[model samples]
Target: MSYSLQKKLVIVSFLFVPVALLLLFLLYPSLRLLQFSLTNWNGISKSFNYVGLDNYVSAFQNPDIWKALSNNFLYFGIHALFIPLEVMVAVLLNNKLRTSNFFRSIVFLPYILNGVAVAYLFSYMYNPINGPINALLETLGLESWIQNWLSDKGIVNYSLIVVSLWRFSGLHVILFLAGLQSIPNDLYEAATIDGAGSWKKFIHITMPGISRVMEIVLFLNVRGALQVFDIPFLMTQGGPGLASTTFTVYTIQTAFKYNNYGLASSLAIILMLMIIIFSYFQGKLFKGKGE
Candidate 1:
């Protein structure tokens, strides 16, 4: 065989394993789920009737599904604050202060911790009776604010949103920090020489410089919000009568708890579609901004 032909064959062989694994693990299961979504499979039996689009219709008509979707949107709203907060921290850390490294490590520490551990830690902290938060409030003579954080329907979602923010904010801070480091100091120096104020320099130079990282951060925020399941599940288990039930949590309950695999599959498909649609729009928005 020719040397060039042998090299091409070796490259093709290297690509084959990953491509095969993707098909087997991802594409194949997705196709099966799509098929299963049209049937009445209870996740165990081989015998299931293909019931057309009934599962999809049922999912749309179900009030719980709608509630769960609304909760997902609310979760997204809470997480949206991370962008600005992380950017602010990143910009401050970018200033070569004496304690910048120490502060950066402190900020990024939470993101490296295990999710379940963080959930349990916060669960204890938010406990109504013995948690430090309530204790501190009482110590300060603010007993009026000491209500059940996880059990109150009105405050449960916000409580969980705070945990999510605390856990993930550090990750965005690191991303923004990386973006900030890539920006040339010359741009800021020039702006300063031109008598540009801090706000003006940030608006014109910093914002434009970090636009690419901003796109990635926004996309991750959207995707993470839609697929949020771990913290809420571990901390609350969609408790207080579905007060903080997310779409993914709802789907898991439908499939395993209720033994409605077909319905759960349909819900999953719907969520996937929603993610895809939102992602498409986000891409367009970012592209327009870049232009």
Candidate 2:
């Protein structure tokens, strides 16, 4: 009945649902996953024996797991290589070029589009027969350049990487654009008066100003690379002999298809640790450079 009591009740009411949901969905499932990682449960058996760190050891010793992890690294490396270009494009967009607004929408449109739809769309585009890509290559009289985009082991991973880039590059660009805009224009003016060229201004002023955004973008890249699933799963099914299979995809197959939930849980744990470790080192490395 009192004002303070009412306020306290209101605060508790607001916090109660979210905190309860977090505990139920996120925290409980995570604890179960950790428990599962230490067992030999085949997922169907209610009677699961705790096998200690055996599953963890098996994940490391498995060559297929290593191969899938390599695919993840490929995605990470390719995306990392493109961050500078994405940043440059963001800078260009920030300059308010002619048709920049139109281009901004166009660049970001792919990211908002449905991921499953994009994968299926690209699947048709990359079809060896009657595919637009091959059609265009044939039109250009470059038949030799046209090959199985999603089938060839050598090219399948790259094809999936292309899809990942298409889906996420705009997000990175938008983030950078926001970061760039936050930078004071007066700094640019001062640099201009000091006779600083475009490249020098980018290096000295722009880089420092948007360093925080850069860190965020890099962390996202690492997470995205590691967790990339739908594109590869829907497109190639991590197929053409596990060529395009990523760590996430492998983890899923291990649990559902192979019915080895214990091993899968271990792999999942390793993945979480990897993301945390990589993000930590990346932060430290960037922080060192920042200093």
Candidate 3:
């Protein structure tokens, strides 16, 4: 084959196959989910009545939808805030302090635990009656602070957010520490010679060097937060009066609970759109970090 023809064949073989697979696996199903979101199909009898934007309208109008959206933002915000903590952990580990590796391993061990385990773990930790947290509170003579962490309408979601932070922070720490290790010691030494204090060095030298890694980590963390299901599902089941319900949880409830498959699919599509929008902004933010 000619060079151009060979190159075209290579592209077709290497690149196009994965592209097609992605379309088949991801894009097509996303389109189908979008279709379901716009119709009234019960996923039972082979009949679907087009409901137009009614599913989305219902979703937008529903108080629970807005609440879940708002809470998702909270989840994202908390994740972002914890980036500093992740950095701190990474930095601490990088110092090669005694037991640093052991401590890092211990911190990262939780991420390997399944979501159900984390939820159940948090549930027990937050149990008002006999959980360890309450026990500690009792010991400290702060028993009045004890309440149903999962059942409390006001604070259950926040409690879950804390659990999420603990679960995912280690991953961010590892990624950031890897980035930090890549930075040459000479630069840090140079900055030190210039009389730059620790804060100044971090602000000028370290932060700029790690900005790209931060961008990537931030995007992934935000995307992950948007898709969270297991923790909320296992612990609260989006319950205690829907206080912790997420968009995904709401979709599940509509599908299995009320047999509204079409509506459920429609909601799923809307969520996909939200994800797309958020992902676009994430890319923009990452690009801005480059400039």
Cα RMSD of all models vs. native, in order, equals: 1.4, 1.8, 2.2
Across 1-291, the per-residue lDDT of candidate 1 in tens digits comes to 999999999999999999999999999999999999999999999799999899999999999889888888888887786578889989999899999999999999999999999999999999998999999999999999998999999999999999989988888998989988998899899999999999998999889888888988888888888899998899899988999899999999999998999999998989889889988988887785532
Question: What TM-score number comes out for model 2?
Answer: 0.95
Taking all chains together, each candidate's TM-score versus the true structure is: 0.96, 0.95, 0.90
Off by over 4 Å in 1: 288-291
**lDDT for residue 232 in candidate 2, whole number 0-100:** 95
After aligning candidate 3 to the native by TM-score, how far in Å is the CA of 90 from where it should be? 1.7
lDDT of 3 by residue, 1-291 (tens): 799999999888899888999999999988888888778888787878888999878877888778877777888898998888888888889896989889888888888998888888888888888899989989999978887888988898899999988888888888888888888899889989988899997888778778888987877776777777788889988988788987788888889999998778877777777778877887776775523
Provide the overall lDDT of each model, using Cα atoms, as 2-decimal numbers: 0.91, 0.93, 0.84
* Top lDDT prediction, candidate number: 2
Off by over 4 Å in 3: 1-20, 288-291
- For candidate 2, the C-alpha RMSD (Å) to the true structure equals 1.8
- CA lDDT of 167 in candidate 1? 84
